[model samples]
Target: MNPVAVSIEDRVLALITEDELVSLTEALVAAGGENPGGTEEATVAVLEAFCLGAGLETLAEEAAPGRPNLTAVLRGGDRPGLLFLGHSDVVPAGEGWDRPPFEPYVRDGRLFGRGATDMKGGLAAVAVALKALKAAGVDLPGDITLACTVDEEDLGIGIRAYTRAHLGERFSGCVVAEPTDLGTVVGCRGDSYIDVTVHGRSAHSGRPADGLNAIDAAARIIALVREDHERLQQDQDALLGAGSWNVGLIEGGTGTSMVAGECRLSLDRRLMPDDNAARILESLRERIAEAGLERDGFAVSAAVTMEMPGFRTPEDHPLVADAVAALSDCGVASGIGGWTAACDGGFIARDFGVPTIVMGPGGLNDQAHQVNESVSIAELVAAARAYALLCLRHSSPA
Candidate 1:
């Protein structure tokens, strides 16, 4: 802790220089930790090198094979600390870019690249903030840890493994630096991927009476799915609003001359905090059977392939209040909000038993996983200042 009490905001704001922020952000953006290719190895190396250069005690361990989670600890007093969390992985670049996605460059005050907005930029902001706090000679009462994990874009096993190993440890709080356009996020919707397959008998099209059309049977199931989604509109949460589901894919039919023998539909369901994925899946199965669609040469089956739980931190939690105050300290107008997409923070909230808040630099849902992705340079710098202030306020001795 500082010998004399002063404005933490001013100290933090003055410490993170503009040139350092831009260079760090660009380096992270250029890493290109695309998950579809595989979990990031190169990105982890870059983060490790940076931490070593900063003289922070760092650890690089594999959460999964070749998928590393890097943690840089700025040790302070012995007490519960704050964890600044972010992921190193990004979704694969599909197409459409004015320049190469991996070559990060700045133009018109925005940093452009594949992972610039979704999270790598946020990680860079956290890194710079921690370095600035050290350079300013500010003493902390508790440790400040920065964790950049892998495989968040896919199954989230990286965070899951890391949290599981560190379950016994206590953290004062955690801030998941997922882009929220500088807003503080307190809750997020859960998501599940369901595969529904409908079976039918095949017959020649010339003899329509003999054929049990699988496509026709699939139509009934589709109707029921749509109706269930509409009914789910009544199940709402204060921050997340109503639960929702969408049929993203449907495939059926062997040929134009034959009745389809099978149909498969892929569903994406978004659940509120209290919604149970197992119960929801079972309900879908029961509804299909109860509707008498299982007979008459029509059979339906559904399975959940991937799922991530939702989380909501109470409004009165100290973490939420602290985050709001931290943003104010940095001169950014921020309010508590909800994120519509599922993120790894859910695992820390549910499994690790830590109070978590999500905040970072860019428009989270708008610019992420989109063509020509970019992040505002100004927001990047401001986020670093906000994070530094948060540490000064929360991790300092009373």
Candidate 2:
């Protein structure tokens, strides 16, 4: 086993395997940090131990009371390093599971469990990739850093904290190890939440005309939102297409006997890089104002509650070419693709001006957050090899 005698690529390919990937993924799934009520502490602990054992310098920081973000570094050179980003928190496993969601198991070649696809599987691939790179004895000119954070499935507090804290540090590039089915995503649509509240006077059913109706105002706003969504289709990008909207939640009417005093609408907006959330909100507010809902003390107010910017990297960027090449070399044939789903990578790309791409092992639309959430064993191994290759190639220029 002469390190100098063997090629780095060969060594990395040999070291990463489906068994190892599964072992790590199963452990991560078993840790069970479902986002709504649960915390990422258990998942962070698992990642910390793995990072330490793989000879990486691990740093764990509490994002919230029990939620944590882990940054593990494979130290390389003086220059900015490559960032491999992921999240530890997963969406809560709701009803409709064939078995317990957190109990990881393999069936037919797929690892099934909550977060296995969206994305403890991706987490394991990231860890395995870093481990293989280290075990292969590759001397990266730039460091390869793995940052697994919390709250990606929720409001994105984990990534925001990481970006704010590392404002002083820079990176050559960022690879977000999200479930991208081993495809490299150059453009991804971002997400945002907006809430519209209407306040009015409640009155008895017999005297409804005497009071302002908030539910009436809310219905008008919903129609307006539909129109706005239609207007957005005209402004489209080649990669990400058009931004869209959905009224995901609505709360109104206290009882059938009284006119509703208040109504609230929670909106989900998918954004492209060109769409400015503030401007969109302002425009929406203007339109709502014109609706004249505030006659006799009924008024509607809307504001953006959460936002993650979307990014589109030019297909000609070196980062895109490099990622495609790495996956191709690993026998995962994929090219530059677009992700309609949003991810934390947008924060890194928009805020830090880093070249970022989302790539990993599972299917986004089908597997992630589904009842039988699962990821292919072979895909996980390929993702690891591709990630290792990307790290090696990324560090070469620096």
Candidate 3:
């Protein structure tokens, strides 16, 4: 409904070419960049090449080889700056695909490939936006920093290292180009991975009564944790909703013949702003104790294997308002929502306290990480323009 948004949207649409968009998508998939922590050389190479092609100066950290995180700065006039964050790494291509997962294919106007909807499409859109900005000769009011990081799928080690070591106190605000179905993602749930180990006694199968079953103890603990999570659901927030937990993995028993002496369970807990990693762990420990399994026959211990805190920007925050205005200017409706999934935005928001938003092309149920995962070309073009307008608006003075 905003007239300014319509103009910006038209400009963005005018700049994105179908051939160019297709080529970028094809190139990214062809690069065959897989693995987290950015160790995949092919992914790093593709990102570097794309940045250079877009006429941006790219820098990579030397501490980790093959796994490189890149940043490029586009300078405008004196105004508050904006940082665009993304990752080049895609999750491993699991089995079963209509076509080869790495080989890009277009059908029904949608580009199908691994990482198509999850992120590579978003990356390509940013590239196209940068190219459009240069071609349009639009005088930027401030600077724009585009950072393509590594290892968002596994842990955010790549971006974390880069931010801590290099980009300390550099930008005013940031936007993580995560897939949000072209809607404004104002917040998301925080996540922590905990490893739980239960100990029991191993005995010969002939005398099963002499030994305890670690698997049984773990199952009881899991049930108690699930029940506690359901209780936590009553405390949901309007944006982030209630925190939750899941027992992602459980392993026990050395072999079928012997009673299992030890079992391990990996818990994936999503936290709300009211919760922290330590608090979540304590709650789990309490639940285990309540299950009456705290004796010598059963043991429980937890360690935070990974942690990514959640954050949100006030609806009226300058960064949030500016981004909404820009998206509106680009002919898109401006609304806010929360993402259940985690991204590097957590690191950016938690570590730097920057007002960060997640906005990108593609739908929420595009079958990401599934066979025939794909993104529509129309969405890609629209996303490119949105990114360009956001860069222009944020890089401009108030």
Candidate 4:
């Protein structure tokens, strides 16, 4: 620790500079393009180089081959440190961009490219913030670590591996640099992906009565889910409200001439911060059984495929207060709110025993994963300044 008790200015710092911020964001967006379950190696390589080039102490651990999680640690002073979290992968750029998706460009004060808003841009912000804070000779109250993971857009294996490894560690606070458009999100809904499979005997459509009719059984499950959804509406939380359900996909039937033997329903269940995924699944199973799907030689099974836990911190908690204050200090208008969408930060808060908040720059609803995805240059810089200020204000001055 340098032991320099200094206040960060509202304006962009001269150390790392704004040009570097923009440049880094562009490089990250370009190298970070990944389809769901695809390689994040290219993006990880670029980030590792940036960390090493900045002379920050860094480590790269592979969550899987070609999927790496990075931790760039800036050793500070004392216990109960702060953790900065982010993901390196982005949804694939499918179609509709004024320019090439990987060819990052800035116009009208916005940086446009895939991953500009959803994340890659936020990753650059943390990298720039840590680099500038170190160069400015500010002493930290505790160790500040930036852990960027992979597969956030898909299975979330990166964060899962990370949390399991650090189970014994502790942190005072965590900041997930997801694109929240400068809002300090204190609570967020968790999410789970479920696969509901219904099995029955296949028979010729000409004599459909010979088969148990899997498609018909599956419909009953969907109906049960619909009723539960309405019940959720009756009970709501101020921050996270009630969890919602969506049956996104349905596949069944081998051919029109035959009765469907197997049908699968892909469901999305959003959870309140306090909801348990396992229990939720059990309830759904019970509903299916009580709905009587298994009555006439029909079997219905629901299994959880993927899970992202939700989290909530009190509004008056010091972490939330410090985050709001930091955003205000950076000349950004920000307030505490709840996110309808889920993020990797939930894992840190729930699993690491760290009170976490989600805050960053970029449009969550509008720009993230959209065509010509982009983030305001000013917002990007403000986020960098905010993270640095949060670290300073959160830790006791030396």
Q: Please name the candidate that would achieve the greatest lDDT relative to the true structure.
A: 2
Error of 2 at 14 (Å): 1.6
Q: What TM-score quantifies how close candidate 4 is to the native fold? A: 0.96
Spell out the clash pairs found in candidate 4: none
lDDT of 2: 0.87
Candidate 1 clashing pairs, residues 3+ apart or interchain: none
lDDT value, candidate 4, whole model: 0.86
Clash number for each model:
0, 0, 4, 0
List TM-score per model, in order.
0.92, 0.96, 0.90, 0.96
Which residue window of length 10 is worst by lDDT in model 4?
3-12
User: How well is each residue in 270-384 modelled by candidate 1, as lDDT tens digits?
Assistant: 8787778899999989988888877676877889987778889988888888788878867788988897788877777887677888999988768999988999998898899
Q: What RMSD does each model have against the real structure?
A: 2.5, 2.1, 3.0, 2.4
After superposition, candidate 3 runs with Cα above 4 Å error:
1-14, 36-39, 62-65, 77-79, 290-292, 395-398
- How does residue 118 of candidate 4 score in lDDT? 83
lDDT of every model, 2 decimals: 0.84, 0.87, 0.78, 0.86
lDDT of 2 by residue, 1-398 (tens): 35653477888889998888999999999999888764789989998999899999998887777787899999887777789889998888999999999899999999999999888988899889888888877887777888888898888889898988887777888888898888889989999999999999899989999777888888888999999899988887778888999999999989999999999999999998877788889988888878877654777788898999998787888888888988898788886789888999898898878888888999898999899899999999888888887877764244
Residue 115 CA error for candidate 1 (Å)? 1.5
Query: Worst 10-residue stretch by lDDT in candidate 3?
Result: 389-398
Order the candidates by TM-score, highest first: 2, 4, 1, 3
Off by over 4 Å in 4: 1-12, 396-398
Task: Give the Cα error of residue 268 in candidate 1, in Å.
Answer: 0.9
Task: For candidate 1, give the lDDT of residue 397.
Answer: 28
